[model samples]
Each structure stands twice: as C-alpha cells, then as structure tokens.
Target: MSEATTHQIPGLKQKKVFKIIVLGDSGVGKTCLTYRFCEGQFLDKSEATIGVDFRERNIKIGHEDIKLQLWDTAGQERFRKSMVQHYYRNVHAVVIVYDVTKPETFHSIASWMQEVESHGLMRAPRVLVGNKCDCGTPESRLATTYAQRLADKYGMPLFETSALLDSECDNVESIFMTLAHKLYSKQPLRVVSVEGELGPGVVTLGRQKRSASSNDSCLCS
Candidate 1:
C-alpha cells in the first residue's frame, strides 16, 4: 500500500478535496473495485468491510489539484442507515456500484440511492457503476440494457468496469476523474492544501460504528 502524501506534499499550493461514496450490496466487489483503482490490484477472497475504508488521492484536472476522498462503505444491509449515516457527511459525489453478475445487487441500487438521498446529499453528483465485469459468462452478465434503464431513471451516468483486467483500470479511474471534473466545473470549491495531509490509498476501518477521519473534510471557504 502506498503511503498517502496528500498531507505531505510540499508546495501543494492549491487543493480541493471531493468526497465520493461507493454504495452497493454485500459481495458486489465494491472493495475490489476500490483497491483496483487506488492500488491497481485485486484482492482475492476478501472479507466484507466492517464499516468503511477510504482512500485519498490528488489528481490534477486542468489547473486544479483536487484531492479525492473515496469512501468505500460496507455494502452490508445493516450499515445502510446507521453506519453509513456518519460517513456521508460532506459527500460531494456518490457512486452506486453493482456486480454485473448479480441481479440482486443491481436491484439494490434503488434502496441504496434512497439511503444516500435521505442523508442530505441529494444534490450531489451521482454515478451508477456495474462492477466485476470480469466475472461470470456472457449469459450470466447483468443486462447493460436494464442497467442503462435504471441509470436513466435516476439521471446518473452509468459505467461498466472490470478490475481484474489491467486494461480496464483506466476505465475505472475515469469514473472518479469525470465526476471530479464535473464537480469542479460546477463550482469553485474552497479547499486549501494542508501540511501533514494523508495519501489517498490509506485505509481506515473499524469493527463497528465506524466513520472516516475528519481530515477527509474539505474546508470550503
């Protein structure tokens, strides 16, 4: 795991941090998708998330060094209202992930969306991701047509990704980059790069009642 240099970058003059939450049901490969994008590797037989794990990375979009706080919340149904509630604070964008091979996971998007919306981030930019495209046969893959329909219904951009294949890494990264651009283009967010900042790949979790560190907050002026 790469140590986060987000807080350690010298001469980080201007920076903005955007909070993005990944939502889905259990066993949908949410964690794998996150690790693939942040660390560029896949975890096999990974245990489910206990609470939430977030990674911070600063990606330059045009002239802006935007620090992205990617929060990978536990997709277990039990965490939706209670655990997810504490972490959703200041979320700027949300990515609802579903497994392409699991119809039930895809179906849970609506419920997940509802939980997120109720948390006062309804105006945040939302994206629908169908993950784990590398799994299952073509016949078992969730229909892109149906996924697109759902995306349209929610007015969220839809993306299908595979983390196991190295070639698809760009596709996965683009999802966050695109939203960062969209978010920056919408408003000039106020985030000052601070000393002692952490890197994006840093993972923070708990066995229960978990929340991301306050350092992830973007102090918008």
Candidate 2:
C-alpha cells in the first residue's frame, strides 16, 4: 500500500493535521462558533478577531486521531483585501457563517461567496452556517425555504445552529470530521450540483453527503 494509505490504518499511524478556515462578515459569530466547538464555552461578547486566530482540537473518528487546525480570520471590510491576497490559499475547508436575525448579514453571503470563488477555492468543502437561532425572535428565525435556496444555489450543506444553546454544535464538528476522513483516505471531495444560479457557489471538498437541515436548537442572540 502507498505511504499515505498506510497512515490511515488503525493503530499504525503518525501525527496528522487538517487545516480549516472560518470565513464570514464581522459580528457574524465566526469566533463564537469556533470557540463553542473547540472549548465548549461561549463568551457573550468578544473583540473582532485580529488578522487571524488559531485553535486546535483533536477528535477521534473511527480509530483515527484527526488534529484540526482552525484558522479564524478577521471579517471586517478592511481585512477583506488582505484575506483575498494571502489567507485562503492553504485552507482545506471553509465555514461560511451569518447571523440569522440580521437579513443584511444574510445578504452579504453573496459577497463572501465571491471572495471564496475569487481565490479559486471553489472546490474546497464548505459548510453554510446560520447562527443565532436560539433567540427565537422573528428576526433570528431564518425561514427554511431561504436557507435551502442558498444551499441549492451554492451546492453546499446548510446548517442552522445556536452557539448559546450548543444545539447542533456537534454537527459542525461532524462535517469537518467527515471532510478530514475523506482527505486522509485520499478520496475526492464531494460537490453538490446546484440547480439554479442565485450567486457564485463555493468549492466543496468532501465526498460524503449530508442533509441540509438543522439537527438541533443552539441559537443565541
């Protein structure tokens, strides 16, 4: 067997790591989502992420230890140019998040999607996340139809979650875990064939298919 394939064998391995990038507009809770998944704690408020912040989490999947190197980028408009110029080149997966309560945040999805495409990372695995679902306010509750439309347009998996309640938070990890497994196994990343053109689609990087539905309630305002 090839060296790469041999590493995937159970109980016969060396250290392996995967790099993941979290991209979204400022105040869209990108950091919160990372923290919630990595540390299992949520801060009510946080300063905007500077140039980038790094977090590492080890998750075991089917007898393999996958070390996730998560890169969180600053989402302010000022940082956009720099990210486009230098940040996304080495990323394995991209998580695009937006605040469900703020339609404007939702509207900006197209712009972020554009950025991802500009970098030619469209083939990368992407997970569309709608945050702040626990608020239960009219604004925070995103219509399933709207999310599905976006998902179909991008050929990506759409997941709605609330970091405050930890709902479907594990699902976020699962998405990345599946991606890592495929990458380690040397399989091609899966791509969904979007039906219509709503906007530019993201690059998908895994072969496994998952439902475009929210698994639990973990919304926060």
lDDT of each: 0.77, 0.71
Model 1: per-residue Cα lDDT at residue 189:
24
Q: How well does each candidate superpose onto the true structure, as a TM-score? A: 0.77, 0.74
lDDT of 2 by residue, 81-124 (tens): 85545657567677889888877888888998998898776877
Q: Which 10 consecutive residues of model 2 have the lowest summed lDDT? A: 203-212
Across 60-85, the per-residue lDDT of candidate 1 in tens digits comes to 98765778888998877777657778
- The numbered model that scores best in lDDT is 1
Q: Candidate 1 clashing pairs?
A: 4-199, 7-197, 55-200, 56-200, 57-200
Q: For residue 86, what is the lDDT in candidate 2? A: 67
Highest-TM-score candidate = 1
